[model samples]
Target: MNKKEKSLLAAVVVGVGVAVFKYFTDRPKKQSIKSLFYLNDFSSISKNFSKEEIEREILKIYKEEINLDDKFKAILFLTMIEGIESLEKYNQMAQETLEEYVKQSSKKFLRINKKKKTGRNIYRENFYDLIEATCEPSSLKADIKLGIEECLNGNFKKGQDIFLSSTNSDKNTFVSLVICYFSDELEKLDKSAHKRHVKNALKDDKFLFLKSYIMDKNNMYKEQIDLLNSIEPQNELQENLRLQHLLINLIKTSDIENKNVNLVNEMIESFLSKKHETTNTVLNIIGISIEWSIINENIDFVKKISDMYLQGDIDTYVDCRLYVFTYLIVNFVEKLSEKNKQNFNFMHLNTDKVEILRKGIENNETYYKLYVYLGGETKDISVYKKALDICITKNEFINIMRILLVTETQNKILQSNK
Candidate 1:
């Protein structure tokens, strides 16, 4: 085993040792240590571990938890363990009750939930209890969906059994999706026969991205960046489809902003210097991050954007930068005051496509603003105090202002009391 694996194993031994001591020595002991170990009492198992070793033991417990002998229970355990391991990054809400112990669940994938605390995907008490309970076919359907999502994300082995065990009627699309993701081509069992599968075949972006991922796993960086910039004027086919490769690219490039792209200054200028810039949509959403800002002289850069076409021919514009600049300004700036933040104004900036931009910004701003409001920064109200939630399903993030809203309401209550 590698050094890291060795370290993890060492930790598991120490952790389990302590937990056994605690179970035997602590007062009010309910169950026997042997019984817990046999039954995969991982929560107790976890207390014995430290660091990543906790995750290692969880994986061990997980293997014992699943089996074809008890197909139904196995699928539930697999899905539940997946959520615990991943903290549901690939699949949000996979384990609703696994909050506290998730600190060390999936050592790799990270997810931010409504609580905004970065943690693991532990099943806590829920998954174990569920699997031990009598679950129906429909309940199995939910478990399979979760498993299928994970499988789509490259966890094929566990996902496949979940597919095989779940009732065929409920999991047809998911089964088809899982099948397609693994590139499993069974004999001509009427590929076109499964409507849900066909539908997933038609609309799912994750499935499409998976195919692209497997075929060209290497050198995918540049290709995916090119794809994210290509999101536009796509029919229903594109709408449901995600440029996940691009999304990953964004995540990687995202933190670079705080570090400063000094060497790439010329590239930065060149990006905005395109003739048919396609709304300067060429820029990654990461470029106009919620963190940084430009100077006032550059504030009028929105005005210089006038030399191009905003929406190209769609909206009659001599310069596209006018609309694109305005969109970025509205997003990056926390709040805009008609009086103070006056030099650069974008609301209703376009006579023709103004409404379209307005609505798009509004919807996105609802969630995005919350991000800036919470741990993010924006001096202006444009960046209000809002809490953001991660959308693991869409592989995107959203802000939840409701978190701070309660705080505001509480403030009002205090003021009224005063």
Candidate 2:
């Protein structure tokens, strides 16, 4: 190779930068993004280039139809086009040229900003980000008062959901309760079903601080100390995270800190699985039914709960099917509407629901989406069917899912028999 060419190759290897023109070879010409029109003296870009050739080139760049990874290259091409176009326009008629460019750009910028502010995002809207309203008719205090009133409760499962849906640092304890309660229900069947979720929640980064905060509010200092010990903070406490630390410290210093395990556990669970505004809203609609049931021991509570059971969305409670089973357990004997009564043969599930669920194993895998997403994977109907019977409340969906799998398993069994 020639000495000059060798020098260039050596420079590239050392990561010494060179001009764009010098670095590139016969790869291709580095033209402006806008190729349609010759902003450069048209005759200079190409002596053979007609006005049509220049216009087409400029159009390609103007649309930015193709994506470019090198933004600076794009800016350089755009600026070059802008300067050439402006010069040409001014040379034709200065007044009209300035007026048109200013008016067009000003309108476009204003339109884009207005659309952004109003949140009228057409391209960005999708179900993934859509927030849906949740409802659960059974819960305490947030719906009823301290007095001994007949309060018919609605959905405890939803209460569990409100707790788990949270992901905030301050919501750690709340998230944990939802997980614990659901996990408890899931565990009744097989620990294998919910073990992953439990492990993940335990490993969550913000859990210890949130737990400490909950214990402090519940006047459980010892618990607070335990949670604080669990956390390993970096550097000093952050200004935003200082409250969590302060609460933990307060618990440690409070009187009788040694003797309140029961109160503290209750307090911690309450803090972890409650939502103020949502609970309030839920109660406002169905408070009477739930509160009435609690006060008078009414049979109608069953019907009120049954409708909620069918219509309820388990996702609110970390997608726990236990809530459904738990609800069904109560509503089974509570009292039912005529239609539900006919279908509600499982009313005394203490005797029948388990059998039905047991019988369903022959038709397993018919439960619901909850089993598929949360119950991990299983080929045997035994583990899946077992998951449904023991899940605390409204566990029907997942139970049904597990039971339906029997159809699949049965076919395979028959084929082997053949």
Candidate 3:
């Protein structure tokens, strides 16, 4: 009741209020499920930490985040991470998460809007950066894994069937199917069927990235850039794809000394470059850039890049393997032909490297063409016939012509000997 007591009570009240406010304001915010959307975050972490450390952090997050949305995101994250062979040890956990995901996702809680939106599209909105449109697709991770396994085992028809069967149900599956069709591992896909699937895949707006990849394959650099520019990238993969194709377009269209090439290189290096080992993914981009450099006859740039990143164990990378083959074949062919030998430096053919590359590659039809070419050079009638058979089977009209030329020359030599 005294003035002193009243003042003390007032001070105590203010102190309690201040303490409560500080507690609420300084407390951590609940982690958002959207954090899993940008895989670049995990990629950056993986670069710095061991896989066990990353898995511990991820598992801690999964355990702490009990909210359904965050839980589903964690499951999908596990699936995505498990897809990388580095985290193959997480296989058991991935299956458990996947089963739980299927159980929960089968409920009618998630609403899917099939009608196209004006920007970014629904898959980005609902799945947070994942390219899948529905929960059903995520559940098909096992099938996708099997298809990839089949492809790796060189069962092209079985792999193609596994992928094609799931295409009607999921955009992710359809994209995988398209990628396998073009990939060297599974080269036996019927051309018409692949084209049809590509046509259908393009009907979906999210497939613009896939379309750009196809455009790049066809040498439509300008068109590919224009198409990529139309939409914003939803995730790290799309963003990387955009940057890569843009760099490729610059290389294909611009002179080697163009400043725009440097600009794109800086942008790409910001994301892709490492002080030590570069990733297989980065090697693929670099490999394609080298290929375009070869096409442009910028041998200086090619040599510089080859020396820089082409060190270490590159044999496992398909694009880099092809780059080596292309470099060797072009060098040999140019020197052998009088008309084309002017611009190219007379680089000695390293037959040892060629044999090593050939052994490293699997049963790829594209690289097999090199064998056909070598067989043609032998000029034996039996070799020529075998080469012709391959050229016809694979629809290599240029190789077919070369084989016929060898046949004609052999015939003339035989008649003269007789």
Candidate number of the best TM-score: 3
Task: By TM-score, rank the candidates, best first.
Answer: 3, 1, 2
Model 3 clash pairs are none
Question: After superposition, which runs of candidate 1 have C-alpha atoms over 4 Å from their true positions?
Answer: 1-260, 276-358, 361-418
Q: Which stretches of candidate 2 lie over 4 Å from their true place?
A: 1-209, 212-303, 311-327, 330-352, 355-418
lDDT of each: 0.38, 0.36, 0.49
Candidate order by lDDT, decreasing, is: 3, 1, 2
TM-score of each: 0.28, 0.18, 0.39
Candidate 2 TM-score over all chains jointly: 0.18
- Residue-by-residue lDDT tens digits, candidate 2, 327-417: 4344435464566446443333443434333333323232333343223334445554544432323333334442444334333323332
Of candidates 3 and 2, the better by lDDT: 3
Where does model 3 exceed 4 Å of error? Answer: 1-199, 205-208, 215-223, 230-240, 247-278, 310-418
Per-model tally of clashing residue pairs: 22, 55, 0
